[model samples]
Target: MTVPAYLHIVQYCAFGIAIIANSLLLHLIRMRAGLSFGRYRVLMISFSIYAIVYANIEIFTLPVMYMQGAGMIFYVDSVLKNHQDIGLLIAVSYCGCLAFCISMLATHFIFRYIAVCRQHHIHIFNGYKVYLLLIPPFFLFLIWAGAMFVCYRPNEVKRDFYRKVIADLYEEDIDQVAFIAPLYYTHQTDGSVLYRISDLLGCLLSCGILGACFTTCSICAYKTYNKLHDSAIQMSKRTRTLSKQLFWTLGLQTLLPFITQYIPVGLVFLLPLFEIQVGKTMAVPVYLHIVQYCAFVIAIISNCLLLHLIRMRAGASFGRYRILMISFSIYAIVYANIEIFTLPVMYIQGSGMIFYVDSFLKYHQDAGLLIAIVYCGCLALCISMLSTHFIFRYIAVCRLAWKMEVYSTEFLT
Candidate 1:
């Protein structure tokens, strides 16, 4: 089969599997653990909504099957006539999905901040704090919806519908000629510019929110993990397990989106400079879909593992959760090294042999030395940062201990 057909099958299958897995895991959590379905409820709901929107886009937009030897062929007959309603539904759902993701991220960071900064504060344990965490995203979504309503004539544009359909249909079979035709047609000035402006604003706002959440969460995670490592705090097994669960879930949650979506999008934006143009644009949609699907799957598995860890550490059934977490951590580290390090090194070597060998020959001695120096410097910097982070965490934990000692002395006096 053609690439498009393969992608279609893969995308749909992954979506189906992820949804089923998440649903079953979530059901098990609720039944076994009397856990309040608070923030996780939002996450699961968002996943379900995204699955429906994504599947609809996949089915409606992509070609059904390919014709043998005729290249990628689309079934034009099954196309929906009134995709306007679908577009609206998708847009609303997508906004909600984004809002929920941001809310969950924000809540995670806020909780971390409270845990680290006000660990002794009794009010911090109050359930009301959870409701308070939802306020920001709720208001942000409302503001966005209001602005979109005021600014855009939703009826005038079919771009979202068209793009969704075209993306699903042609993503795998992406011939430059075929791709550019739809892109040109879609960009034609047919609607009030308000819709475009609204979209731009929404994108900017979402980016800002995500950036803020990521920054705050990174600080919190680094600090918390550092303290834990340095102080060697004899936490209850439950606390240690919970902390690990939070660390891995929130860490992956923050990092994966950047590694997958943001970085790939940035690379696409920089493609103009490379001038090596063998279907570079086609890579974007494919990467976007792959990243999104992978991130969601990882998130679901992480959350499920987290639930299991919480239960197991809190005196439930077996110690299987600890084994699962350890297995996952090992797998993730190995996968990261392979994907991020080994594959990239291989690609660089292969590409250098093919393209850079002749260029290197001309500036052989100087270029080789400079490249080695730069590589070594980067490696040194990474090690230094890691060391500094650990040292700082140790110092902070020591300070906390001193404060606690002083308080104890005063109480005794």
Candidate 2:
């Protein structure tokens, strides 16, 4: 099967898991959920509904993501490939779905706080008021989706920036591709890259949304955790056990995202602002070295080919790009060699992890520091080269000459 077809299988499997897993959860909630869980049970079901909807969108859109600096480009490779407008909407809506998940989880935390700590205010979640609480998540979903739709709209400039990379990577014509990117900077008519205020603001808005929801969830989670253990609550053994179970359940849900979504996304967005790039790693246990090594081999071989091609075929047609590509290919090969030779090892102790790669050189380990520096230097070069190449494409296509004055006021602001 084709790559996307395989991805579709994964999406379909997730859909099945969503349905079955959520079905089981709902069944448990229906049968065993106590009076204290009445408000939470309803919200939990809605959460499952959101999950199913998210999976459904993935099945339809099947987006492939590529991150560049503080920006991300999404290429939709599903049935909607020909329908760029619809595909764009579907792709942007993925953000909404994730935001919905965040908001719903936050709502649950808010409700849990009410149920556990402030029973007198529990009436706020009863009757019609309960459904009213859905407004925040719904609003957040709209805000997230709306911001992306407005900021990341497809344009010649975007296609110009990513055209060759997309064409080279996906082997598809940029004209026919349906892609969206909320770029932090766009190459201006002149040669310099300018900060895309809208896109940056959109990203900041997303962070704000995330922060608000997380803060709400954290405060509520903390309060609920405390109240569940409080001695003055005067609860029966059964009631206390059920309340504790619910509190723990909600806490686990909150933590899963902090690991999966919040922290990683924060880093992904942050690293770009400072122009740092760490090519790729399993970031898991040592057993995953097989995957890392396989990637290293692939990187080495592909970069060798890329370097050779640039040398042989990157004539006048490649122009200035010829130089950048050659540098990148060399950097990739060196990076792979560094990984392979060092065979870096990492271990976890308590709550922290440390990783160090000793150079294969004998006795004199002074070279290890140089190896580490080279690795970081390669990443920085890779990131900057990518940005330069994209701007080159933009300037070449747009043919806009940037005056030196443009640099002082608006470039990379």
The candidate scoring highest on TM-score is 2
What is the lDDT of every predicted structure here?
0.45, 0.72
lDDT of 1: 0.45
Model 2 score (lDDT): 0.72
**lDDT, candidate 1, 1-413, per-residue tens:** 12434456776686687567667656765575334333444444444454455455544444232211101122221233134344333344333444445555666666665554456662544664545666766676665444433332232233333334345544431221111110111223565322244434544554565566567667777777775565556666665566566566566666655665455433332332232222313233334344545554565556566556555554533222333344444444434332322111111344363212122222565754455444445556556655754554555467767534543435535
Candidate with maximal lDDT: 2
After TM-score superposition, what is the CA distance of residue 333 in candidate 1 from its true location, in Å? 8.8
Task: Specify the poorest-scoring 10-residue window by lDDT in model 1.
Answer: 176-185
